[model samples]
Target chain A: MPAINLLDKFSRFSDQWSPKVIAELNGQAVKLAKVQGTFVWHDHAEEDELFFVVRGTLLIDFEDRETVRLEPGELYVVPRGVRHCPRTEGEEEVWLMLLEPISTKHTGEVEDARTVRTYDRL
Target chain B: MPAINLLDKFSRFSDQWSPKVIAELNGQAVKLAKVQGTFVWHDHAEEDELFFVVRGTLLIDFEDRETVRLEPGELYVVPRGVRHCPRTEGEEEVWLMLLEPISTKHTGEVEDARTVRTYDRL
Candidate 1:
């Protein structure tokens, strides 16, 4: 089978902060997510999340009061146990690949309002 | 800190078949490998591998007699336990991001002649 085209699959989804699994390797799940506005303040206590700007801009807000602005073609890792919230302005959408386990929730903490159980494939 | 720019780091390396650790997400390692010529046939028995072509072209040959050609700005995942070999012709270099564990070898099997310890960062 042909390799999965992440951008092509991402174009099929319009929901923000909803991440979908694109592929999995070695127990690590590669997820594509659309982001606008701001995500919840949570930290992956056991796993570091990778953020790749596939389309628009993404700002990774850290617990240290630092924000890393990511442009297209750029990627960053939010270290394990570090609190962060991602945000972008305007109507532009940000495409990201979160490398974690399939069991990982949208919010690392349980019972959050934005936590999603069933993932959508786009 | 700014997000890691994969292409920028790839520009610093000119050697072929050398994969560098760019970042680690969760328990999985994100590696940047420069590939040319042919790699040894192998398969990750424990984890699936992800290949994102940042430059040049890459051909993934599978044990099932299938071959997938990848171009720049494209990505593919080699499923776990699937035997495969990667190769490229000409002087063109292919930049790839391998999402596996730090313990995973270039050639998945033990006692391989092409195996290298201690990964370098580009």
Candidate 2:
């Protein structure tokens, strides 16, 4: 497999809230997504999700009213079964690298219009 | 859990080839290491390893004589049970983020003076 360049992959798509799989290792899929506005509250039943900020800032709001803010070159992991919503604060688009199990659903247990069941492999 | 800043974590250590765990997600450990020079060739029997270059460049050499060169913002995964060695060229030190199983041994099946059985959590 060739080396995956994060920025080059991000330049391929412009859709928001849609994840594109870049690589798979140890049963986990490494995905990149361009996100803006707010996402729905959802939780994966048995998979932990890692969010690594590649560009811009990201705010993750939990059901308990706790918020985790991530900047570029930072990462945060949301444990399984924790309901959270991810969104950007301003007009800037956020570039995120997500790591989760291959079996993980795009929107976890909650499916809405923003749900992307099939992800394109970049 | 607090968001982990890659640069801040990297600033806390200067040891080469020693991995410092920063986060644990889904039974997998996220580690950071500053590496220079050559490392022993080893392979993990039951775990795949991911190498993400945070700064500088990295070269991964496989037993089959294949080499993968990674630059900043690039990532490569070495499949399980593949004999490989990681090294950096020139005088610059490479910053790397490694993802592997929690139970994975640093040196794999080979134990030598450079082996690190216990990694400090940053």
Candidate 3:
């Protein structure tokens, strides 16, 4: 496959809270998302989730630990089974590149309206 | 684990062709590398590798395909069992973020001087 430009793939979509798949390797999916507001508080029972901020800032709130704030060029991994929620302060959307197992759910086991069952490939 | 800044991890190490592990999730290692010159031709037998360029340019030469060029904010994945080599055009150093299985060898099965046995965790 050809090289995928992160910015170019990001420019193709504008949906908030929805992540687009850019690439996959070693059973992990590489995704890009434009996020605002807050996501659901849930835990992946078997998969660690990687969050890499591409632009703006992201705040990951946890149920039992202190919230972690992520900035551009920064990355954080929420271990499996850790309850967490990701959000963006104010009205600005946060751009992110995420890595997770292909079987990971969007909202874990929680039934939410924003949960996406299938990720669209860019 | 704490949030990892790619640039901060990159600043702490100046070793060429060696990758520093910044994070690991789902048995995959997220690494940062400062690379110059050309790498040896090799292929992982059972693992795919993702290469995301942080700075400068990278050229991936394949055995049966045309070379792929990657730039900042661009990413490419080399499928498992594909013989490929990574290189740079000039003497300028290239910053890269790599994602691959933790068990993957640096130069695959190739025994080279630049091969790293154990990756330093940054």
Candidate 4:
């Protein structure tokens, strides 16, 4: 397989909060997404989600109202069954690398308008 | 858990080829290591290894003589049972983030002087 470039992949799509699969290792898939504004509060029942900030900044808010702010070159892992919502402040776009199981649902058990059931493989 | 800064983690250790576990998620461990010079050729029989270059450059040489060169922000995954060796050229230190099963052995089936049986969790 060829090398996956994060910047090149980010240029492929303009939609926010949608994740595009870039590569799969073992049973986990590596996805890239450009996010802005606020996402819905949701949690995966069985799969843990890993978010790596590639550009800009990201804020992950938990059910307990605790917020974890991540800058470029920082990462955070949300354990399974933990309710969390990811959002970004201002107008700056945040580039994120998400790692989770292939069977993971984008919005977990909550199916809202922003939920992406089928992700494009880049 | 707090946010994990890649640069801060890289600064905690200076040893080469010794992987330090930084976080755990979904039965997998995220490790960081600084490497320079060549490492022994080995392969994980049951686990696939994901290598993400955070600083400098890395050259992964396969047993078939195929080499994959990775730059900063670039990632490559070595499939299971694939014999490969990681090396770096010049005098620069290479910072790497490795993702694999928590039970994965660093040196695979080979045991040499460079093998790290125990890894420090940072």
Local distance difference test, each candidate:
0.78, 0.94, 0.95, 0.92
- Worst-scoring 10-residue span by lDDT in model 1 chain A: A97-106
| CAPRI grade, predicted model 2 | high
DockQ of each: 0.70, 0.88, 0.94, 0.79
Deviation of model 3 at A59, angstroms: 0.3
What does the interface RMSD come to for each candidate? 1.7, 0.7, 0.6, 0.9
Accuracy of chain B in candidate 4 (TM-score): 0.97
By summed lDDT, which 10 consecutive residues of candidate 2 chain B come out lowest?
Answer: B60-69
Looking at candidate 4 chain B, the ten consecutive residues that score lowest on lDDT are B63-72
Q: For candidate 4, lDDT tens digit of each residue in A1-122?
A: 65566788888999998899988887999999999999999999999999999999999999775799999999999999999999999999999999999999999999889999999998
Docking class of 4: medium
lDDT of 4 by residue, B24-73 (tens): 88889999999999999999999989999988999999977569999988
Candidate 3 lDDT over residue span A1-122, tens digit each: 89999999999999988889999999999999999998888999999999999999999999888899999999999999999999999999999999999889999999889999999999
State residue B67's C-alpha deviation in candidate 3, in Å.
Answer: 0.4
Q: After superposition, how far is residue B49 of candidate 4 from its true place, in Å?
A: 0.6
How many residue pairs clash in model 4?
Answer: 0
Error of 2 at B99 (Å): 0.4
Candidate 1, after superposition: displacement of residue A81 in Å? 2.4
Alpha-carbon runs more than 4 Å astray in model 2: none
